[model samples]
Target: MDSIDLEVLKTAAAWLNAGHRCELVTVIKTWGSSPRPPGAMLAIREGGEIVGSVSGGCIEDDLIASVARDGVSQTAPFLLDYGISADQARRFGLPCGGTIQLAIEPLSGASGLPELLARLGRGETVERRIDLKTGAVTLRGASADSTLHVDGDTLATVHGPRWRLFIIGAGQLSRFLAQVASAMDYRVTVCDPREEYRMGWDLPGVELVHCMPDDLVLEAQLDARSAVVALTHDPKLDDLALMEALKSDAFYVGAIGSRANNAKRRERLKLFDVTEAQLARLHGPVGIYIGSKTPAEIAISILAELTAVKNAVPAELLVPHATAAPMSVAGCVIP
Candidate 1:
């Protein structure tokens, strides 16, 4: 699953290529408790068709109304606002007097959206600058080697598919995790040297590899934005890959095992000269303590933890509701 912004851009490109008149709306600023953040986008097609969102339904209704009345004849970009007043906030269902500012621009040849999509498809980040006054747009290529400039004020940068995941075992759990991760726009790879595990694997959008798990980890050149998860219980398969992963810049490195097994695994890693500092980075009892049981529920817990780390959200903020008790099965608390 691509991000909502990328999806919006792709949808807009499709509509534009089909000769349908459409306008792109981007949220440039927000106040109070707006539903969407800056850079949030929505594409409003002719005849009130829409893709993506800028608010909680009310603002979309307003945009649809505008499209029905004005069509896409306007060339100049327009700044639109909603929920500026208490009454307006209540009318739009924005809690506690929230407000959002949007820049509406008509797409054309000069926008270079199709070219931008092409570059993004190649795993490159690009910056799109829109003139608030004239609706003119400029596209610039960006990478680790490129510098970004926005007048005297450097605008926020947008990225394409940069997140990656390397799964150690190609089991049933790996299949579920791979599908969920792909929907989150991660380029996923499953590595398993055992023929038993590799023979029946049949998931789309995931790369299946028969190379040694540890070698595959090194080949991927795990970076700060990448993640590694070991699903196999075998120490020979999981330990080598995890040892290399802990040495890399991967932000999240985890393994699936019971609490006692996790402790035993850590003890085993001590023999390999791994320091306590590096060992601390491992999330052995992987996932938040959600008390999940089934493989599907366990997958959700793991994804939730990964997303929390990615977004830098505090764990305290994610405490379960007071009314819900922890889930347990067969004397094992699955978290």
Candidate 2:
């Protein structure tokens, strides 16, 4: 699913375009153990219709109740705090006596949300500055070279698909992985020089590149926030790219292969002077061991693992088969 922030902004823009009244709520700060983080957002329309959430449910209920009772009022932007007391924390389902602060403002044509969404559609990160006092919002394009600062009256929040995936192959598994990654809001790109593999490849929001895998990886210059998956199973194609990827900052670098093949690949990389630490970063036999026999199931397993890593969850807790009881199938034992 798309991030709740993007969904909330898009929903607010649509309501405003349709001449409906809506308010945008953003979580500016949280004290401790809050359900939502600092950038959490929610959009509430005139008739108590909601698009996103701030708290688990209690805070949303409060906002909806306010809207229902008072109707849509274009009041000055204001901050609301919840869970400030022990009883309030218990009532709001907060883990501790954590307090969350929300900035509630009315959405209008002048909010610059539509323009921001357009920029996000072009795979660009845009910073939205909202004036807490005057309620005027401005949008600015952001890049690696951009500088960011927040003042007393201006709040900035980034809105876009912040993750990217580069898959080096267009085979059946790659197709399934691309589909799943796209559903997870990862901007996915597939690179394969073989025409045979690219002949029938087709998917929405996925860029297909007929270029050398290593060259494409270098050109992409993947950052620490990106992921690279080598699925071609060809050393000449996958190995070179993986070597470069390992040297870069991509959060996840993986290759698809059988366990034995993965071991052999590691040995070959060692011969190429790759460090033990770099080799350790490689996730061979990529997905969590889930006994996934079909392509779709395997893709799900891989994406689940990637999601866990992206969210910084412990791998042991994320992999279902890792913690579950061991099982056996077809002369193969799974633990």
Candidate 3:
């Protein structure tokens, strides 16, 4: 599943390649309550066709009409504002007097979109700078922490995978998690030394590795943008991986086990020199406490918690974390 940003990029490239004039619209700023956040993109073709969205449908309709009537006449990038007054908010379908500022640039050879998409295809985070007056563009390497910056006359956006997940087991739950994470644009990897488990795995797009779990976690050079989850439920596999993962810069480290088992795993990690603080970072009872009962539901819960952490939501702002008391069977809470 291609992300909306990727879809916008792809469509713009196609339209430009086909010799059709295209205008790339990016939400640069928002006020009050907007439908989409800044950096959300929409591509408008010379015709009425569009790929992505800016504000529900009303904004897109205006954009398509603007591009079609003007025919990409603006060679340089310009800004457009919608929803300034209460009447305008109702006209553009913005709620609560919302406002959004968009940077609309006519696509050209100088846009550097093809190169930007290529770099993103290589899994490299790229910082794209567009000269709002000249329609010129510059591309540079960006770190995971880089974000979108829109100045008075320039728009710089970050593109690529900003999140990664390393799953320690290649089982049913891992399959669901991998699929969902891929859809969410997370570079996912499932590591296991067991050939039998890997041989039966058939999920596409997710990287599968046949190697020692701990070695993979250590060699992974886990960074703050990464996460590690151990679902093998084996001491030899999960314990070593957690020991390495908890000590790394991974923003989230988790293991699938009961509350008793999670407690036992922490005790084992202490013997391996994992500090109490480091152990505290480990989310033993992984996922928000949703009382999920299936592999897919558990997968959703786990990803929800991971997303909450990614968004830097305070603990008090999030739903209660799930605890592992009684054992779960087939991922369902045993009543």
* Tens-digit per-residue lDDT, 36-105, candidate 2: 8777789999999999889899888888999999987687677888898989998888887889888888
TM-score-best of 1 and 2: 2
Pairs of residues at least 3 apart in sequence or in different chains that clash in candidate 3: 289-322, 293-332
What's the C-alpha lDDT at position 49 in model 3? Answer: 86
Cα deviation of 195 in candidate 2 (Å)? 2.9
Q: Using TM-score, rank the candidates from best to worst.
A: 2, 3, 1
Consecutive 10-residue window with the lowest summed lDDT within model 3: 326-335
Q: For model 2, which pairs clash?
A: none
2 or 3, greater by lDDT? 3
Write down the RMSD of all candidates, one decimal each.
Answer: 4.0, 3.3, 2.8
63-173 per-residue lDDT for model 3 (tens digits):
778766767765688888999899999999999999999988888877888899888777678899998888889999988778898787888988877788999999989
- Off-target runs (Cα >4 Å) in candidate 1 are 133-136, 144-157, 195-208, 219-221, 317-335
TM-score of 2: 0.87
Q: How do the candidates rank by lDDT, highest first? A: 3, 2, 1
